[model samples]
Target: MSRLTITLDDQLHRALKETAARQRRSIGSIIEESLRLRGIRTYDSAMEIVSKARAAAGLEPDEALELAVREVRQLRREKKT
Candidate 1:
């Protein structure tokens, strides 16, 4: 496994610690789960779903990312209507 070093602000750090204590889990596990569910898919495992879609649509990764951004903007506009 790989280790990541991130700098969290004091309040966020404290919150993570508290969550870990409450759930009886390591801080790393909590962070991992949060990253997985946060909807902003930057991690490889998260991106794989988009990657598969791009392949099915015959799009390159960069093209897929741009298209995804446009779709999100369109959705936001529709929501505001």
Candidate 2:
């Protein structure tokens, strides 16, 4: 395990502490979850995820690529709203 030190503004720090207490989780866990939600992933990790999804769906490379493109476009449209 590694340790990280981040400087947060007083308000943000307080909010994070309170959220952690309320959720019964460590501050590190909350921050890690936030990072994951924001798509901070390595290329190898992302590829593994894609590989698993492709296998599960039984999709060929081209079909997986097309589906991925469509899903990305749809997410973009939804995010714009």
Candidate 3:
């Protein structure tokens, strides 16, 4: 487990608390969810890079998309067990 202490302006703090109340969760949980939402940007960037790299490395768009989808589906199947 880890501890984090952060400072926020009055409005932002109020907003976070309100969101937590609406969701029936803690303020800490709201902050955690915010982080998770931001982390999705990393995945989006990585996929963009992969597509660009594939093109520069001579893989076609359709080929790259197909490979990405296939790998993702294969991973999901493997994780089921």
Clashes of each: 0, 0, 0
**Candidate 3 — which residues are off by over 4 angstroms?**
40-81
Estimate the lDDT of model 3.
0.73
The model with the greater lDDT, 1 or 2, is: 2
TM-score order of candidates, top first: 2, 1, 3
Candidates 2 and 3 compared: the better one by lDDT is: 2
Colliding pairs, model 1: none
| CA deviation > 4 Å runs, candidate 1 | 40-81
Where's the lowest-lDDT run of ten residues in candidate 1? 34-43
**lDDT per residue as tens, model 1, 1-81:** 899999999999999999899999999998887654444455675477667769888998988877766765676566556
In angstroms, the error of model 3 at 78 is 28
Candidate 2's TM-score: 0.60
Candidate 2 residue spans exceeding 4 A from truth: 49-81
- Candidate 3: give the clashing pairs: none
What TM-score would you give candidate 1 relative to the actual structure?
Answer: 0.51
* Candidate 3 deviation (Cα RMSD): 10.1
In angstroms, the error of model 2 at 10 is: 0.6
